[model samples]
Target: MRSLRRTASTLALLGLLAIAGCGSGSGSDASTAAGGAEGVPAVLNFSAPLVGGGEFSGAAMAGRPVAFWFWAPT
Candidate 1:
């Protein structure tokens, strides 16, 4: 009976997790005031240091289409 209870609790927890993991997919908060997403900033007030030298500016990349590449070690 205890094993059956544990199995039921595990199933219940999995169902809860699955439901919670689902997103609404509306894409509202993820956008800026100009409705731009993914590295498209509505305002120009950010910058970052380059890997080699100098610094990159966000103002330079605003209102333009660019390709972004990401690398990760798994």
Candidate 2:
């Protein structure tokens, strides 16, 4: 009974340590960037010239949700 108890305690301790290690950052640039604060907003701005010899400026889709789709020429 004592041996079983000791084994259970050891297993619990190992599980906690494993969880802590998994939660720690992986010490990589990509990992650091991925750990940013939740619900934070990111903004990207750009201006491109139109094919009809005009400039398109301003937020193309401000205050709106946008989805992008890509098509292949296959």
Top-scoring candidate (lDDT): 1
Off by more than 4 A, model 2:
24-74
Model 1: residues >4 Å from true position, as ranges?
25-74
For candidate 1, the per-residue lDDT at 64 reads 63
lDDT of 2: 0.53
Query: How does candidate 2 fare on TM-score?
Result: 0.32
Residue 4 error, candidate 1, Å: 0.2
- Candidate 1, residues 1-74, lDDT tens digits: the string is 99999999999999998996797764333334354445555554456777676987665766564555534448
TM accuracy, model 1: 0.33
lDDT of every predicted structure (CA atoms): 0.64, 0.53
- Write model 2 residue lDDT over 1-74, tens digit each, in one string: 99999999999999997997787664322221134333222331434566567866424544455643433346
